[model samples]
Target: MSAPTISYENHRFPPQVIAHAVWLYFRFPLSLRLVEEMLLERGIVVSYETIRRWGRKFGAAYAKQLRRKRPSREDIWHLDEVVVSIGGRNHWLWRAVDKDGDVLDEIVQVRRDTKAAKRLLIRLLKKQGLAPKRIVTDKLRSYGAAKRDVMPAVEHRSHKGLNNRAENSLCRCENENE
Candidate 1:
């Protein structure tokens, strides 16, 4: 059979160039400017603004694609919340991750009460399509109500030091925001 036809008529650069540009933005926490500077040193002449746009357009898609191809979850789910400041207002960010540290979902809310916890659970349920076999959370009363309401049958456990995984995840986000 003849070789497959190649199509580079409309694009300015090859697929490998675009993929590398997108990979630099997603695989690291670096800003677009940093990525641009790194590429500039390597003789690439792309702009930071272009990199920013590529990230916004392709980051979520790439993340979703990678997640879909990953192995099945095998660890207990961990849930936690942290205080965040957005638009000069204090907010709470609730997050859930699988046992191997894959972020399932996150929600930013005004409070960490029962309603917020329930919303977080709902969001995760909608994304993951099933409740975790076991849920581990801190000794927050709101979590108790949320667990009962959203995942009645899942084992809910609260113990000191058991929620370190979730707490560390939140801590990482906090540090990145600073």
Candidate 2:
């Protein structure tokens, strides 16, 4: 089911300010203080705490709206993760792609363990409000472990090449960053 609408009727600030603050917070990795400063520079006086609240309150609504705009996704899902080196630290970027090559969801974490896999799966389930009929991943034991717990009824395939769609999409993102 689609998410119910959230009302912003009682807030003191104009809806525009609230929307802009939420946009700035999610559009970039800026901290709340930085977002507050940027809004102040634009002559909008809002506190960092207020921005944080707005993010906590409205982020889901925005995400829901965006998802509703997308075409309904296919039931077959491809999942993959790759190591990304930032400075001297290693992080695993996990992603899920549907049969049509659309990104269903993504997450970045330091560990590529069962917990991380479970988290990605849970988040994807929550965001899409639908579970895939099948999931394909590389031969990662973590994915198998997570799949059993999170989506026991769904089919899980562990193959080296089945998840190339997600990996290739991540490559395109990395290429743009470079």
Candidate 3:
């Protein structure tokens, strides 16, 4: 498949500069102003606002293209979740991985519940385009509830011990600021 073209119409800076700025902003945890400062240090005078706009314009397409290039993934899925603090707020990150530890997909939310579990399942279904041959998750009731509703036909192995594959991948967050 041909790669999606990025449009650089009507921007004063060259396409490479705009693309690089957008890439820096999305490819790292740095804030928009930090991206601005980094570019300024490199002798580029673009504003943070411009970097933000570029990220908004091009980030999703770039991510989609990259995902498309990834090889087809394993059918056995191990799913797990952990609580993380981002910007002083608690968030639950649900992640899925194959047995070999390649990340399949992940989602973050404020609540860890049936709805959140279902959303993760739906997203996995949509993105991977195939139901897993088997899903292994911890003994969370929400996973059972979601699986019954979302993909009852697929085999589900729920065991706190069996899901170590997914759990080990989490690298649980520790609050270092304390």
Among the numbered candidates, top lDDT falls to: 2
Superposed by TM-score, candidate 3 places the C-alpha of residue 103 at a distance from the truth, in angstroms, of 0.4
Q: Which stretches of candidate 2 lie over 4 Å from their true place?
A: 1-74
lDDT of 1 at 16: 67
After TM-score superposition, what is the CA distance of residue 111 in candidate 2 from its true location, in Å?
0.7
Ranking by TM-score: 1, 2, 3
Pairs clashing within candidate 2: none
Kindly list the per-residue Cα lDDT of model 1 for residues 1-178, writing each as its tens digit.
6434333356565666666788988898888888899889988888988887667766666665565533333447888888889999999988897786767788889998999999888888777776777889988889889889988988888875898888888777669899
- How many steric clashes between backbone atoms does each model show? 0, 0, 0
Q: Kindly report which residue stretches of model 3 are placed more than 4 angstroms away from their true locations once superposed.
A: 1-74, 172-178
Candidate 2 residue 57 C-alpha distance from true site, Å: 31
TM-score of 3: 0.57
Using TM-score as the yardstick, the better of models 1 and 3 is 1
Query: Candidate 3 — worst ten consecutive residues by lDDT sum?
Result: 169-178
Q: RMSD to native for every prediction? A: 8.1, 7.9, 7.8
Candidate 1 residue pairs in backbone clash: none
